[model samples]
Target: MTAHIEQAPLVRRVFWRLAPTRLFADLISKSWMESVIPFVLFVGIFTYLYIANPAFGTIGNLQSISASFSEFAFPAIAVGLTLISGGIDLSVGAIFALVDFAVLFMIGVWGLPTWLAILLAIALGGVIGAINGFLIGFMKTRPVLTTLVALIIYRSIFNLITLNYSEELAVIYIEDPTWNFIATGRILGAPVSAATLVIFAVVAHVILRNTKLGWRVAAVGSSKKAARHAGINYPLVLFLTYCGAGMVTALGAIFYAARLGSVAGPTGQGLEIQALSAVVVGGISLAGGRGTVARAVLGAAIVFLIQNGLTNIGLPGYFTAGILGFVVILAVGADIRWEKNKGKAIEKTLVNPIVFSFASTPDTSPGSQSPLALNDRLKDAEGLAVGLIEGPEDVVVDRLGRIYTGERQGRIIRFSPPYFNEREVFARIGGRPLGLVFDKDENLIVCVAGMGLFQVDQQGKVEKLTDRTTRNWLSILDNSRLRMADDLDIAPDGKIYFSDATDRFDLHDWTYDSLEGRGNGRLCVYDPATKKTRTISHGLNFANGICLAHDGRSVFVAETWAARVRRYWLEGPKKGKLEVFLDNLAGVPDNINRASDGTYWMAFAGMRSPMYDISMRHPGVRLRMLKQLPRDEWLFPSMNHGCLVKFDESGRILESYWDKKAEKHPMLTSMREHKGYLYLGGLENNRIGRIQLPDADQNWTAHDSYWGKS
Candidate 1:
């Protein structure tokens, strides 16, 4: 037992320790520390400072430190936003200086009201930002070069103002209570600067995560081309993000200059570097559209701490520079480390395979697992007498051990077992039939790509249950479950549960569906008694497969586009909540069926290329791909290599089976085990393949075949 336990992970660990594969694996695995790392660093470094210098821990000193952090924090956040859009705003520093001067000049020199000056400062910043956006977005200038040039131009104008216009600045008073409050005063116990931080944090957080802007910004960053194809205005998204960043930075500068009571030559200068550093520290990549505002703030806090710590300890400028360099190198290293170790990281998230083995028992193993580098094809069936099935999308079985398959020409056909003989069309539908499940009443419940839910009775009579339950746009738009009804399974309560894979695109346009990468598929329950379908869960990604748990307390649904499997608990502490049962699956799971041994069998509509799987982890990469490439050349979920995977109710993967090419199983979308044989169906193939399951019941074909049989 000990030896077997030790041997279990030997291959996996060896594979992971191999640097190339390990690095690829890590990059794809998500890090919870992504959000928590900054906090840990904040506490750790600050605690050390407090212990080293007593004054640093004092409330008054802390207030000043927090104030200091917020001023830079705002500009850094702006930089973070632009960076996420795959650009940089070198003018963030210049804009801040101008806003400071503008506010002072507008209010102090021109006799404008406080509110008016603030508004003008904000408006001017937005306009200038629009100029930056126009250059980068419309002119097609490179982000770094364009922003760098703007930085220089703005600096020249700023210096000219200082050199020639000090006389105009003379009219401004050195102090005003209102401006002072913005910079230094408090409301109740909270510092005003702290309040600014909180406000920006909240607003930025919502825009980047909860709003359309957030998604659009991410889309542009990932791939402008793909975003446009998905109907997103690429340039507009970039322009608006830049505009918003400019406004936020300008406001922050208002507070900064207000605190100082003047706009001087040194005001708002060289701050962009600090902001960039902070954003990188917070995990926002220079590559774009991946990090958050909170991360940028965290990066800003780290910078503030570093500056303060080095100054107090009297470190040399060179050493301080070295520390900043070291920090950058370290963050990048960490990010790279994470990216490369993705598969290893995913392997860690799964329950131990030993525990997984317990779910399948001694006779069973997972069937959808990837095979060993496909050295050769199966030899025994190399010369068998067999009839080929043409373009079979899904395969089902009746109680007498006969196989039923949904074919390409909108028909379901049946084939006798052994040498897999003569096929005959069982029923006809309007379009392709993808998922097939034999229900309690011996009706084959199916998902028809264009037609919706359907059933085939014994004599091949077709019955449409409910397919257009969801509006096409509201179905699977954005590669989510817009409207393409693909697959289904029956619930124990006799309800027909199915997947509307996408409302956005049809079966042939599956690639477009993947590029959108938005949640769209929905899970619906069709009550046969009333012939009504109600959406049970909305916002799934290409909802490809459905299976109710053996106990019927929960259901497992596959979100193929997201490479995720989620469990919806009907009765538990976590009822009605969808939780990630499995994520970053090695394959795109297509359908789920009950196995004879009290487990489920899932077909991999596609297998994941390690490179592609890792790319999903980087929002910037995907968005960027969308922006640059035409739809066809872009990345897609690879269904060419397909498999049959088995899992228990608790999501323990038992084992897997694989066919490396379309020649064997091509996009195997569904599978059902019947009477000692596991039958496979392919969405794009012209044949149904059969594998003998040694211990499976040989008496049963599909339960539907036993209709009226004694």
Candidate 2:
């Protein structure tokens, strides 16, 4: 018996199967699931109705639904327009009833032509809207209170007119065939009024989306104070917006009057409530300035469909009203909550945090004999224009020997030489300017952070050279705009090669990019002859320093976080090929400049540390640190110590310089050899350092070395 039981357990087997519905649900949960909510709700409702009642999907029922939606669609549009302008109009229903009575009174009682009566009715709406506009816009009255008053006054006028002329309004019918046809005709299996609704909705959408008036209204709605500061004429925008909304409501009124062939005091009563409900349900924010007319129409359709479906299913009228009210409350509450927590939610989703353990620290072991082990010699250097500037990042000497450097205030300051005194402003280019170079025509080309590349002439006038580069198709982050443009060098062929360091973060939040340890940088080229900009190489790890070779066949670029130097060939047999020139560096390399004797000088903004190296190997750990820890407590690259190293064409380390004390110069970003003097600049130093280079070519100028006798 024991042997038989063991055999049964071995023979039995079970298999599990997964359904397609589960997979779809998981996919939707991971992506932009909120965007599909409305569509899903619509489909779910339609499916439920189709299964419950077979006739709900028939052609005739759909047509009837479309017809009813067309009548209320225009009023919904009017309410939506006001909502987008950050205001609410409570008198839309009153305006509709007034127009309906006027059109009927004109055509039936006054015997006026149908076309003229319609025009007058629309004009009356405009006139009433102008009154509301003047009081609320110019007098600064509250929109809700002003419109509520107008609603009462208009309704009272409508009631008085109907009571005084009840018999005439009841029996005064126009027998014209054209009027009758317009009111009751069908076109292509749809109501004739449906065409008007579609046409007007399209026109309104275009006006709001693509017109100056639309922009002004949006500005006012976004912030009244900001709109005034931007010179938007807020009162005028508000007045015109209200007038336009009134005209839209009048259009809907005309359609209703023509179709129904009669006017009652309450014909358009409670219509405003339904319109508001539709606008809110359609995802139009009640707080304003953020919805489209198409969304309004969609909301109106949903509301109408729900009502029609409920009635067809034998539900009571009160049930439909109560359900609509519940929906409005739920939608408004959801929208408010979404707006409040949107930033936190996005950060939580995008940020992945983990702990990083180092595979190995930097080569800081004793007796290793590294190049950055020199003592402090920068203290012996002279500080030029010491107290006149702040944070001189990159230094350049013009043909006239004026020291030009970018300041923290977005101004290029020029210090007249001889004694290095007489400081004056060169040009005002917005954003933090990082790299500086001169084109063939003596135009000062600068790579500005947050702003793109720019050119400044001799007359202190600035012009935008190029701000856009070719976009990478598969990039997870947007790389079309230069984020932190760090360094640039002009090639011999009049092409400007620049490195956009870390497109994912700006200059201030650059530590985040380092923590990411992903390739989020690119090398871009701007051609002067064709006036075009394109990206030549992408997927670089924080590409920073840039220098063109003396042979004009290759360019040297530094990857800051990766601690490597890469050579991109521009001509000869290796053209368009990229190869590593230096790897496993002791520090984070910054700006690279060509020496007078065909060598390159590289600056280390920060020497590599143990924890940072370990962090680089475990990206998941770095991500966790970024998400869980405060920025002040986060581990960062060691950017305090200053060092410089020189290399030849074959990537041989020739010599190294250091400022161990960092008393005069710290955080060395650039080191340029000009006339036997190594001029150094730092990202946050108050003064510029000039050190004597005894063995360098004393008469060689960078301008002459690159573009001779220009």
Candidate 3:
């Protein structure tokens, strides 16, 4: 008891000493600090300014500084939208200039009404946006390239219409009173332009935060492939988003025209840098699929402050570009550095509790049996796999009806049904086996958590095929190499579909995986012919199970963290489409199977627990873990109880079953219903169990291990 008393205060002191300020000081001492990178150059600028002149901090100057958000606010908004959607827009400056000149021509030379000219200019923005969207969205062109074209096109046109024409001296005058009010008038002591910018932000926030459109837009940005599976129209949503962005740029162009009282090549010129800087510095990720409008505003304000402050303090004009460039690089660098530092903090938070739990006699063993019993109708589940895998997640059958299972240590054991007795080590691919599927030509595909993809032949030979897709296009942050490749399915042509469950954290760090929406989970595909791996989608909380459609036209993926199923269309007008197949799931989906009856059997790896729900609802738990714990021992929800649910191709819940006590099993990972019997596999279990199903096919026998047996 005295020992406990002494240790408690020691623990308390240790915790207290790790507080923010102290750690920050320690962080600075590390030779590197995240905040230092971006602020390095900016800090120098601010210091030079303050030291050079004390009045720079005055309220009047600050207000004037903030007021200038008007010029580049719209461009920031554009970049933010693309960033949130998980892409970049490099052509914003050229587009802004183009829109500015078009409005000038329409109103001054065409003699159109100011409102009409603005409308036409905005329409032109949309037109330019449509071009960008079509190239990137439909053609699947790289964003940098497509936008580069738009950028060049718009800039060239701006030059031809304004610079070249002005040399001959073209005239387009701005004379509309309402347009002038919008550009110059003040309301509530703030620039009407600023107010308008706020309104733009609010509208964007609503779309991104309040509605399904926002979710879809974000989904597309995170993973175009995953979004397609979720039934999200990639092109349509992205096209619409880009078009809207174009409209926003047009608004900026109008503000420029109104502010300058004319349209010229220089209008809206060289502003993309500021806009991109604002969005990025505000914390919009360069990789996409995660950002907020409020952040955009914050970013814009900072950019405006810097630009205004530097000019006011007598900095050279050339320094503005250099300063902006430095800030942009710093922002990205700082974000990464911050996250790295943040990861260490999170590790502490996550691990300390678990450590404390251990110190307090943590239950390292499997959890106790559930008190509640389930009245389940899914009695037999054997019809799904027909005995491919037998022991806890033992066997996984591919398209060729071949069964592959893992043994005590690392050997991949293959089995067949007719004899159904002698299971031999077909492959020696290491790591514990989790899920499996078949490609078009009957090649076996396996998901080995720490190991990644494995393959086998007809003669019981094994090969370590791939740990991840090798392509220059993806950036997985260290977590990209399939920490836990739980389950997989194949598309019609031969694309290997799988999930990378926790990119920031690995399989063992599953708890921290749930805490932060770090977006490490990803849906990826490997092309056998091309051997190229691409992250079709990312930002998933924890993507798990997978199963392709019988029609060979659509693929379904399970996001365990999101508690939902999503479908991706492989062909037709809706190709590259994604939609939520099911939502608010009762449990985290594990492995999925397509039943003979045309429905899909989704294995609920664990039932819903209020504890898990609460934890998920508050992301701070994860953030705190990031702030405190190490990578491994963070607090996370346990997936101990098992449940199986039936869903049709349309994602409608057909029926469900559960084993609450975990008596027959603990932590069920996959369930295959074959021949009136259900065979189950658990991630951490000793045996496979069977139950008789009332309506399953009687003759549905296990597949012969003819393929993947080399």
Candidate 4:
């Protein structure tokens, strides 16, 4: 057990070395990467200051920074909360000033106790905020406009009251020991307000991340219409969000008033602008939705540190504001660009190009003499259910000659034949159904991408079989469920084997899987008898097709991106062993189906190209090309030209068939022989193809070969 545990990480290391996307996918996936640049800048600034000034890294200076940060941190959190709720509160600074003046006036002018005055002042802030909330939420006023108007009105009212009582308030001297201690007390060598700010930030972060209220706020901010459709009460949420921001601003005002021992018009002047700049610089999107309280605090800290450091360095006060403004613009621009081009950025930074050399082949030359040469054999083939089907990627015929195929609309359709004239909706599987087969009871089992394994009963009702396999714990990305479950083939003892092709990319983006060349794919099995699914082997490169061997002792799997086929033993002495069946193929393989003569029919979904092969040798070139070029111009698999090949159980290529022009059938994904006719299907083609197999078995059916004749 110990030996096995130790080997797991080693296996993963080897897997990632062979397939490099594992190195950078997780780094780019998280929202936190946005914080990295600012954090680096913070570190660089701090290091420079500490080296240049001996007093900068001292405990006294650290304490000063912490104390100053507490003043802005709470207000920044207030603004961040409102921003995340898809609204703005520009009156926060006005609210802060009003609260400070109200508390001092009540205590000094009216002889009220400090505690009562503080409570009333805080309540007054909420009341004022509620007025703004009502205007915006209930009265349908725009948030920015309503708040801007509120700021002007509140500031005028504050000035009018303070100006009237200025003479009487100037002579009063109020002092409270408890207020002083609360304002300046120390905990663990840090200021009480600073410690309290940390506690509040942590609590706010938890509430935003782990609560229904936070989810609602995020939904509203992300898209108001979508949030309403999802049944969130937008007006109520907005109202409560503004009310909460008002409460936070009140707390900050109280702290500021106590620390300074005085209140003035300039007490909270320019605070709203500074806090807003901090929010954007800290990685909170001003456009709305995604942000955290931690982000708010980080932004506040950055702002506080930069301001303090500039002051210590004897820089002019105006330079501090100018630098912050520049920072905000740069941060916002960087964020917008990153959001717009993240996918291409990920491909460029993470996916490694496959370095490969395609040696000269006569088959690829002007005049090919190999038996696997391309010709017009497929052009002469006839189309079946031409207008009724679209993109029948895999086609299988039941005993009664009913053709079943998966379509683009996440449904499996059945065409009944003598001539396949009747088209019927079989089942709505709710996923892109790919590889398919039948169980012993004639239930059609399917592999649905983004979903899991499923089966369609005789009544045409679809049932979920198993969507989860044993998670590859060593995998860099989460692999708890089958992602791109592409193909499957059933074993005799009620076990179904399937291929999960690239957990990182979806079926529609299979080209990305090829571009990545990462061994992020796996093979899994579902046992009907046990009602369980498990991984058999993993770390395969784009596992696409699965075919159970004729003797029922092994299964053949095609690693499409790697151009290889592998065999995994299911029974006999070699049980649980895996070995390569075929390698260095002429094209990228897709699906493999059993043939009556004990051979196999494999489809080349795409042929190899010289340019693509050359480009694979330079990962940097591939990555830059992916980012710089349009989707249609990127170097990708030559999917326009493909062919079908017949091979024996020993992995020998028997013969190849092709459509040289590739007009009728550009990409064949799967092919199966039924009686004397070979049925073909393409992933993007609009029709099912049928061609005569002259010397093939006339009475062979996959159903009979597995379950015996009825």
Candidate 5:
């Protein structure tokens, strides 16, 4: 076991000890942080009301608040929809009043059935919305100006109709069961309107977050020019958005009419202002394209609670409005400040380095007798596809002896045998492909750095096998999405085992993960029969390479940053167990692959340096260095040297290869032994290296070893 050093200053060392709670910092970096302020305020206000006024906690009062909140939340959501679409609907209040008046008039004067009246009322609101949509979307009119005029016209029409029918409607009462139920019935212990709002909120949230139409709406709102360039119908999306907003507003009107059974001139007079304040306070951006239905509902709840709670506490109505307005102003100011500083906040706190110490490692001096001693064995190795490829991180050989490697440009390059001069593009899979392997079907399975596990057929048709695994329930960030799949190998049962390098950073920012030095990696498996992926192990430190063992009962995994190889048993008595196979390596291991001699060949992508080793023991110092210095000046492993080593199953190093001059193959990431020849690949080099293995088996191939000759 490795020992940790405790030589730092007391205060700094004690402060660094709290680094594990960086998970909370990770949570703070997510988009949900935008809702934090409003949610906290809501909770504080509710707690104060519940303690200050016993009546506020009463079941009757709670039910009343729920119903009222539901009635108001619909308008808030409607206004939010328009705002999210880069537009505004100032006519929501007028539409609400008009719909309410129409519903009551139909039920009382026209003698229409309750169901028919509700449908007609909703349609009326939709028609008004359609009008606003047409004028603003198709007519190229300013949304604020168009909706303001609409509000005026619709409100005037409501006033005129109510003036003619108010007295008559005041005397008429509809004795309808459905209307009564809508007004006061409860479902599963909540008001019907409240229950319906919950369902609608969930659906709207899903639509905004997970659907294509929602994406289009957000795109248009974010940038109309960009959306148009992306072939989106901006006008149609806007029109549909406004139309949907109107229908949602009408839902609120239906519940309001049902509860009151009356309509008046001032029924929905200031509703538009209230809804605008609610959504903005709830964290919806007035500039558009950045809000959720849940936030809208939460805003409505906060506003309603303040309004009702103040009145119940004997505060005057005007004073209540004043306080609500003050809250809205504060919320808007806070939102702007958060938008400006959130990125900086995350940068300052995201990389929480922990104290990580290493045991003594093997020496690789030039004249040392150790098996891992430096040498010039790979200095004269032949280069294949020189200058024709970039960053071939891993190399694989097929049954036909064709050489395959992944390029930094996101294409697989295949070099024909014999002179190895002819080259062709094998596949154009995006993302930096890190590890390559072939299954029993001869299909190439790859681990892409940014993408997830993918398979390429014989014809080079790419198919995504899986990109996500079952999520951890307690994780703050969504761990389901695979962030950086690094290496993979296929099991005999056809299950694909892989390593996700890091959960916190992508390929480009991998250096940051190394600086943090946390266990942010995991081992996952994809079962083709179930079409599902699941995480098998968690808390791996930069899990990189994977290779199924010769016995087929275990697999070797390279924990790159930890400089160790671990064997995970897959069958027999030790199934579902992990044991360290090689420890305290001279360099950071990258990829592990099978050797023709039944041992394993592993590449050391970078050698461990004394400064980096010292820094690991002092995480506080590392954290300070990360925050105070530029990235290029940070202390890290030395990737300037290339090295490879062969190890037997007994955990003894047999021999080592090195490019001591760092000329031909620096930064070796993988090595494959095929037909008595060892092929090398590097993540930072421009070519593939080949050296003849004189004493090795001359006829063995990885293809035949995994799946017998055809």
Candidate 6:
């Protein structure tokens, strides 16, 4: 098999090895990609106009466009907010016309001050919105029907008032500085209306994304029943949401009246349809609970550009309207398709397996002179809590000689000493806890597989220390959240150092990480003083074990799939330096811990087989195997055999122990030396093993070695 794999074409090997670059597929699957369609349309439309018409690019024409864009954007945003709350506001156009008439009547006919007229017009819009809010939100009327009725009533009132006062409105024209400036003014080289739109967009975005009210609105929109169950006042949220929409619409109306200073029977007509088209084109989901203020503004810009640009290019009004109508239909169809297939697309391309080259395996047969020679020493080891616990991946002993270990069921189990029969649950952390250690204060610090670092105090209360670190700026995926925190150890200065096994896969999908054979792991440290966690070293292959050296100058970390151990300097002349400590191990290394005699004991969770080694060298075969065969049939490392080894500070293997008969311990994951006994733990074993070391110090405890006696 090895010869055949090596003899395959070089081009095939290179193609398989480059599979790691498929991470781009993951980037394309993010929610931000929803804006791509609208953004592309905006850019394409703008570019076409700039190249086709010289007047479109002038500063004065651009400013006019900006003012018109702002005017249209306000109504679009007003409609978009209602959509986000799972309702449609068809009365937006009517309310806009009524507010415009109110502003014109007060300022021109009643001879009111500009400021007073603007305030009264805005208040009038709010009152109309409150009526709609009361009907649709409190009275439980269908949103579409209630808003349609409001549109008829409000439009009729506007027409009646304008019919009686048209001659009066036309005869009197009051010129006020405030009104004139609002109509045609610039702030920082931008139109006043444009500046106001920018400010409003920023505030709306923050409210929707960063506030509790915004979260409640989204929750209610997603599912009213769910929001009610979660203690959200569903009716109240809708009411306030509509009220806000009304006030915003009125503000836009004020700008429109100031710009034109007149009204007609068709003023603000068909604005509801235009706003709805703008929002849908800008990527606002029609079903609600998903959109942004920026998207709303972008959609408004697209609509305005299409209409204004078509007119400028001599297209008839009916032709421009027809084109926009078609665009809206296409946008809605695309939105539905994207919402349905985004997850499927992401899952299909998430796993990208890469090629790896393996060196020759060393001999570890019985009676061999190699330091990693197998033995039956662990076969006779005594089992503690047999059949009572599941997957005690790591074992630790406190100063009282009490045994502690983590189970696969997200629980820490404790067993009393003497006969070792008394058992109790220490803590229920709700995540598969992998590594266990006791800090100086006797708090149990754990590295939870799917969760991040946690601390369990004497009372068994769990507190999360940190779940996220600084993200890599260049990484396509968000790598800040710890995906799989596998193992950890503390420094003398109270800083906690740990290994994140893989940033890509969670605990259950860890086997995929090995199949990919890529470096997706990093070593991080959590400082107690600053309450911050930061990455120290990255690009490690399944970094599993972490053990601070006995001298406190460096730490040793195991790269499981790489079959190597690394040493990172902490305080010596080589501080901030990382180098390989041991290379080419006989098996896949797991947890590493200190021994009483100043050495470290490491567990091999699985041993490498010839078939698995050959598979690693040929990623193309593995990729095909993954696609064709069932998961259980895929070739993986040999995890049925148990093995442990002891090494000194110089990285020399002193001895090896193995359960050659597979009787007691079938797979070793961790080992700790305390009071002359070696406690064994396994990832899939139902019991903990203990074997006495006659030549070791019987009086030493790990707690005493790290922090001295209390």
Every candidate's lDDT: 0.71, 0.81, 0.67, 0.82, 0.89, 0.88
Candidate 3, residues 431-511, lDDT tens digits: the string is 767776555455667788788877766565566666875332344123446677777876656668888776545555566
Worst 10 residues of 3 by lDDT: 354-363
Task: Write candidate 1's Cα lDDT for 168-212 as tens digits.
Answer: 786567455677778778866567988878986988788888888
Query: Which candidate gets the maximum TM-score versus the true structure?
Result: 5
TM-score per prediction, in order, is 0.58, 0.87, 0.48, 0.77, 0.96, 0.94
Residue by residue across 462-502, what tens digits does model 4's lDDT show? 88998888877776556877789999999888889999998
Off by over 4 Å in 6: 1-21, 111-113, 628-630
Give the range where candidate 5 is weakest over 10 consecutive residues by summed lDDT: 1-10
Better of 3 and 5 by TM-score: 5
lDDT by residue for model 6 over 1-710, one digit each (tens)? 01122344677667875664466565676667778889999988988888889799899999988987887789899899888888889989999999988998899888899999988888888888888988988998989999999999999998999999889877767689998899999999998999999999999989998999998888877888999999999899899888888888998888998888888899889999999999999999899888878888889989998999988988899999998999999999998998888777766666677666666676798899988888888878999998888999999998899888999889999998887777799999988999999999999999998899999998999999999877876677788999999999999999999999999898878888888888899999999799999999988999999999999999999999988899999987899999989887889999999988999999999998889888887776777887788888989877889689999998899998999988889999999888999999999999999999999999989899899888
Estimate the lDDT of model 1. Answer: 0.71
After superposing candidate 5, which stretches have Cα over 4 Å from the reference?
Answer: 1-17
RMSD list, candidates in order: 12.8, 8.1, 17.3, 6.8, 2.2, 2.8
Query: Which digits, one per residue and each the tens of the lDDT, describe model 2 over residues 104-146?
Result: 8899999999988989989998888888887878888999999
Name the better of 3 and 5 by lDDT. Answer: 5
